[model samples]
Target: MKPELISFKLCPFVQRSVIVLEEKGIDYDITYINLKEPPQWFKTISPLGKVPLLKVGNAVLFESAVIMEYLDEVNPPSLHPTDPLRKAHNRAWVEFASTLFFCQFNMVMAKEQEACDSAEQELRDKLTQVEQQVEGPLFNGEVFSLVDAAYAPLFMRIAFLEKWHPMGLLDQTPKLQRWSEALLKRESVKNSVVEDLEQLYRDHISASNGFGASRFGNA
Candidate 1:
């Protein structure tokens, strides 16, 4: 039986696991849930009531990182590197990448220009830290690792924001910019989620009238 993934449409964490699954050619079933109104069963299974819960038979796995690790362990072409030290290093960076998601969330929800500016600076700083460590084409040189999966969704959102808003977030970071462009064009990264994701993000910016929407400024 195919494993089941509980997801939210715009959740980057969920996207990470989905990208890994697609990359490994895993057959899986995914169902999007309303985060605000997650079912009772979901609540019972997820201690934190978050998306990206993986159900394998009667076993349930929470947390996107954990789910991805499990999938990689069970599937072929292991997404994580073979060297123990390198794998640990990649894992640490994956955690670092996760922090950027929160930075992005705060940035997206920022209503005022000042708040927005601060959030952007925070995100840029975090990305810069990742940039210094990136040896791309993929996160760990030529081989795509879990680190690549972790950062793909972040790049996805940034790509959309850049096109619609022109934030110049990646202007000074050539390595990350090239890395992101590579991820954006990847087959697994491209097909990991709903086909209308970009449009959905645009609609969200317009509807929320948040910092991302303001950046467009009638353009």
Candidate 2:
């Protein structure tokens, strides 16, 4: 039986899973969940109550990064590089993109503009380090690998954020800017991203007079 993916439309984390599924050419059932009313079963499987949960028979997976790795292991069109050093470099950037960059990006999403500004400065400093570590098209050199897979969604979200805020967040890191542009151009990335949902989100927030705790209801 094919796997089932439970995901939110606007979530970049969920988009990561979709990218892996497309890259692996896996046919699966996609169930869109209302972010305001996630199914009870989803919490049981994910434990963290997060979207982008994947279920295949008896196996269940959570966390977009872990889920993508699992899918890559079972499916074709490997997202990770075979070379040991390249693989390590990929993993490093993936980690930085998630833990470092996304954390800061989330602050902006959460409506902490001042905090976001500070976080963006800190993230820019970190991206300088990342820029020094990478030299070519993908973090692994010529091929798109797990790192690209992992970082793509974050970059997409950043691009969306840039559309509204234009904080010059990616300005200092030319490597990341190039990487993001290339990744966003991929069919897998393009198809996985829900641009409509992003626009809707922007509209919703605009209607609410900007995001606040009351707007999302204690999320």
- Winner by lDDT: 1
Q: What would the TM-score be for candidate 2 when compared with the true structure?
A: 0.84
Per-residue alpha-carbon lDDT of candidate 1 for residues 1-219, written as tens digits (9 for 90 to 100)? 599999999899999999999999999999999886888888889978888899999998998989989999988778888999989999999999888998887777688878878888999998888889898777888888889999999999988777777788888889999999999899999998799988877666666686656774232
Clashing pairs in 1: none
lDDT of 1 at 165: 73
> Relative to the unseen true structure, what is the C-alpha lDDT of residue 202 in candidate 1, on a scale of 0 to 100?
68
- lDDT for each residue of candidate 2 in 86-190, tens digit (9 for 90 to 100): 777676667676666456544454465565456666777776787787666767677867777777887776776667666676788888788878888999998
- Could you list the CA RMSD of all candidates, in the order they appear? 1.7, 3.7
Looking at model 1, which ten-residue stretch has the lowest summed lDDT?
A: 210-219
Candidate 2 segments whose C-alpha is farther than 4 A from its true place: 110-113, 204-219
Task: Report lDDT per candidate.
Answer: 0.87, 0.73
